[model samples]
Target: MNRLRFAPIPAGLPATVPFTGPETLERRSGAPFRARLGANENGFGPSPRAIRAMADAAAGVWKYGDPDNHDLRHALATHHGIAPENIMLGEGIDGLLGLLVRLTVSPGDRVVTSDGAYPTFNYHVAGFGGQLVKVPYRDDAEDPDALIRAADEVGARLVYLANPDNPMGSWHPGHRIRAMLDNLPEPGLLVLDEAYAEFAPDDAIPRIDPNDDRAIRFRTFSKAYGMAGARIGYAIGPAELIAGFDRIRNHFGINRIAQAGALAALQDQDWLNHIRAEVAAARARIAEIADENGLTALPSATNFVAIDCRRDGAFARALLDALAVRGIFARMPGVAPMDRCIRVSCGPAEELDAFAGALPAALRAIL
Candidate 1:
């Protein structure tokens, strides 16, 4: 008789997850946070049209989603001025990253990313048994030269970079990215994450050839559309590269209701513009609050503001803990230099008021 064996999972499994959601913070604290300002999510919520569409599709929730993501893909294609064949919808950028890794990376392959950049990409690479070579950020932005050098040095199969980066919120102009695109090596995929492109300034998003196979750009309804919970994101690239995703992706992973909502949301361009204005105002207010507290808030093209803590990671972490205890959910950077700051997401006026009210006490408690 064979006894139940307790062998462990493979050692290649990542020791840590890419990032923790704000729900985990609430669970750990054993209390609901008053101001949910972490996670860089748009607290403004999704378009009213999207909500109505989701509500209308509620009865169909039991049905499986379209495997081809047909309606949504066509709508996205129209939105991006590309053919449907050039677009591939995924559960979210997270799920897409996993599938991309599976499609391109083999065990022991090399991947390149910016040091202290998005952790989710690293998480996917590690899960696929790929070695990650990280390049340090230059002036708080992903350095194109350094990334190209690292990719060349390691003979990387893929390189990941988030324009208008997380934590730092700095971005390179679109023209700069276009110039660097020509330098990228062959047989290597550039995973350009443009999750925050809507928030970035004009000329910050490059216009690449829709048929460009050397790079694939990722966009999500999660950020500016304020539908992070909906988990809808799409990748735009060469039809062949985009088509390759179907071989390994969970075809029905994007839910029926989510697809309906995303379709409506895409059609509501006025609402998106309104939210963009709201986000800009919130960013200004956050910078004001930071200045009032004698802290320097970094200029941001993303929804959140990163406030330099004036000390080290220890101080930034202590401030984060204090803010959390004071019912304000905030997060800090995970590495040195950059880690000396705390990140706070833009929210409604009341939530910002809560953060402003808690600032002094939290600082005192931490210091």
Candidate 2:
């Protein structure tokens, strides 16, 4: 009789997940959250066309998804004005990060990222036994130069940066990002997570050049397109580098329904623009709510806003717990300094109203 055993890394690591879903939390609390905003999901929902397309694809669930992701890949290539060879579809940006780590990061290889940039990327690095060298955030944003410097200093195999970063919702302008791409240490690839790119200003988005070897940009339908459940995203970069993903990528990982939804969502530029406008208004409202309570809301280029709690991490955590108790699902950064802010996702006016009604009471309870 033999008990189950795993590889050395899995055998030694604790059972920890990057995120605990709202459903699980609701189950424990005995009630669903009033405003589900913690996950940074697009609450306005996907395009009606996308929803219909997904429904249409539902009948084909019995069949395997196109392993090549051919049609969708060509669609994204057209959307970005790049060649299809430069694009590779994956389960999501999260999956792409995992695949990138697997492709480039041998155990004990150095990886660089901002201290609180994106925990899931860090999660991937850890799972793959890569040594992470974290640089601190500069003014609540991912410091591009600092990340590049760290990568060069450590001779890193990978450097991760999320433009208009998560948790903090801060962003750097395009020129600076282009500089980072140009100056990124050789032999070390840049993993640019643009999950929230649709919400950003024109100046905040860097140009996508398929021939650029310095970075591979990952974009998803989860945020602005309101398809978080779709689990579809695409990566654009040098054709050869893009092809490397074939070595280890899950051939049929992307589902048929998700593929259809993402393709429809991409073609619906009108819907994407509408979402951008809605997100912008919601960001302003979140900032306004923070101001009404005498807290400061940082400028955001993403679908969420980060309101400064005006105190330490302990207070922020207390405030977050209070929000949870009030059935509001806001989240916060998990580290020092940056942890003094709470992140609220952009949602419908009604959900934002629920948040506004809960904010004062939650703050007072924590106080």
Best by TM-score: 2
Best by lDDT: 2
For residue 348, model 1's alpha carbon misses the true position, in angstroms, by 0.7
Write candidate 2's Cα lDDT for 111-221 as tens digits. 999887789998888888899999999889888888888989999889888887998888888898898978988888888889888888889888858788888899998
Which pairs of residues collide in candidate 2? none
Q: lDDT by residue for model 1 over 177-201, one digit each (tens)?
A: 8866887886677899999999999
lDDT (Cα atoms) of all candidates against the true structure = 0.88, 0.90
Backbone clash pairs in model 1 (N, Cα, C under 3 Å; residues 3+ apart or in different chains), count? 0
Q: List the residue pairs that clash in candidate 1.
A: none
Worst 10 residues of 1 by lDDT: 1-10
